[model samples]
Target: MNGLDEAVAASGSDVISASAGSLRERFEAAFMPNYGVPPLVPVRGEGCHVWDADGRRYLDLIAGIAVSSLGHGHPALVEAVSRQVATLAHTSNLFVNEPEVLLAERLLGLLKAPGRVFLANSGTEANECALKLAIKHGTATGRTYFVAAENGFHGRTLGALSLTGKPSIRDQFGPFPLDVRFVPYGDADALRQAVTEDCAAVFLEPTQGEAGVVPPPAGYFAAAREICDATGALLVLDEIQSAIGRTGHWFAHQHDGITPDVLTLAKGLGGGMPIGACVGFGESGTIFAKGDHGSTFGGNPVSSAAALAVLDTIERDGLLENVRTVGARLAAAVDAVDHPLLARVRGRGLWLAAVLTTDAAAAVQAEAQRAGFLVNAVQPDAVRIAPPLVITAEQADSFVAALPGILTEASA
Candidate 1:
């Protein structure tokens, strides 16, 4: 057997089989049980600390897969949601709510986009909105076809799924929407060849967040912009996992200095609350008219208020600067770990990961958890680190201090 497979098998034996039995049993009984047995049954969280059902506390580094930007149950979020619920919670799209309008304005002011916002409840829903907008643009301009990158992940909805290049997600979910093409990510020539005048849009992820936090090389995004402009295809960036200060910037794509025709956001926007949006830019802004696309609970007052609180706290608390400092220190620490088990470190800001020598990512994840820290094995050989933006230097130090021991345990 391969070295990675053998290590993975060895690591699996060390997992505490009934570590979270109470919550696991409850989950199996209550939920549809679709997820592959949850990692931990977290009961509460504060700052970067999470307590599981058995009262085990671990320093959180995953940040709910880059969703919980401010960390769990921040006072601002709690107050915002509480106040919003006590005031006005849910009003249909037929009516304009104050928080929704305010959130739209706030988000647009920060984003490089020009057009209006269509809010949704999740990243997938946000991508669905972008797809609808793309369809509207295509129909009006007599264009079809979409170009997406290999290893790209947009969302799970049929249309968004069609744009996603992962065969594991698409192979079973046919027959999908047609006219979608795939090309190697970060390859300007591949993108240029894939996009044509007939294509409606080209979807991309700034850093390919789920693809092991893979950042494109220099000029890749610029090249994409050039191709999209040359072919009359709108450029759409899926910032669902890389936006909302997760990467020490409003969006990871900002580092590339290129703006997209449309952008989808969700993961960290609401700071643990469910909210998403599809924002259009330039001529692509005015594509949506009335009744073209809408969502019921998309911009519900509570969620919008939660987003407002998150934005307020990020600005007032200066968490972005904190993320920059802590992320750099942590990245450097990982690089200096000097373990044969790790290949290298990748990503920018706080969205980083350690590529492994062997495909023992899951083993490493378990070992880290046992070592009183939490991380994610997003890819077989990569462990993604997307800690809360509020993570402090001390917390970053704690994680780094534990890495060698965790790596040793994982490798064993």
Candidate 2:
């Protein structure tokens, strides 16, 4: 036998066996190395819990990087996707579908504003659509420059990656589309200085999710709106990670009582199905004419149906209110622990981060995994926690209770 076959035969009985090391070896041999080595092989999931290939269950706090809004294996999601796929799966963009129309209307109603929606298959595609709209909107006025905030993450596509401020991810991919300037996040004064009549759009996030859930300063969005209005630049909010009840609201910007000219959404929008939206408000909605943009699998019936089910379940089950209450309890519990290794807790609703006093977040994450929990060390000193919106106060408290021990062990 060849070396690879010999190794496989020596390692296990079957390829799908519950050995993470063997699975990881096979994965590395087969897939590209972009994601590096995955630490766990999750075989099944339900609600706020997931079971690994080894049959080890973990309290899933990250929830697929805040994408699993209704959590895993939700019956509503299953039913909607199953029903839609069985009925009519794909008609491309040539013909419209009921689920697509219904989802668009529902999204607009939730925004409580008049707008037009362009559906896509992911957050990056949604941002690409929004950027195209912004550029087109500026065409009538000769505005071509775009502004975004440093430390803000939009997406990884060429257009969206240009708007992202992290140099580590961006520096390697240039020469990108030009004329994009980045200002400090939460610094309205800097944003005011940067925006001008020549600027086409200013992209930002209500809270910097990938930047360890850092929230903006108070009244920052209000100030940003005023500045954009004065400068005649479109204000676009990237709500991909913070929207769809992840932040205890339909959209995180609602907390600031400001309406952006354009909004991009994805992540938890479809519970687990891939879907995204670029919504334009008022005059901004009319910027796109025919042939400006299009996507083949943009708003397919199955994904739209899944999104509809997620929205319905969130409302029917009162998951938004649950997020608010349980999120507060979780944050407060972290504060109550007051561990010496913990610096502070940042973020809102179920989306939170335990900022560490030392750069031991990776160790803490490893320790937490060993303790039967899943958390993300988003930075050297920050561990992000975004449980499913349906997570209970009791479940949150369980994590909170385990955190002190986890931190203690990590520190040691």
On TM-score, the candidate that comes out on top is 2
Local error of candidate 2 at 263, Å? 0.3
Hey, what RMSD does candidate 2 come out at? 5.0
Among these predicted structures, which one has the highest lDDT? 2
lDDT for each residue of candidate 2 in 1-412, tens digit (9 for 90 to 100): 6553365467775644648888988899999999999798986688899988787999999989899999998989989999999999998899999999999999999999999999999999999999998888788899989999998899999899999999999989998876899999999889999999999999999999988899999999999999999999999999999999988898999999999999999989988899999999999998988888999999999999999999999999999999999998888888778789998898899999999999999999999999999999999999999998989888888888899899999999
Model 1: how far is 209 from its true place, Å? 1.4
Per-residue lDDT tens digits for candidate 1, residues 172-265, read 9988866788999999988887788899999999999878999998999999988888988889999999988877888877888888999999
Looking at model 2, residue 28 earns an lDDT score of 95
- Models 1 onward score TM values of 0.94, 0.95
The per-model lDDT (C-alpha) reads 0.87, 0.92
Alpha-carbon shift of residue 226 in model 1 (angstroms): 1.4
TM-score, structure 2 vs. true: 0.95
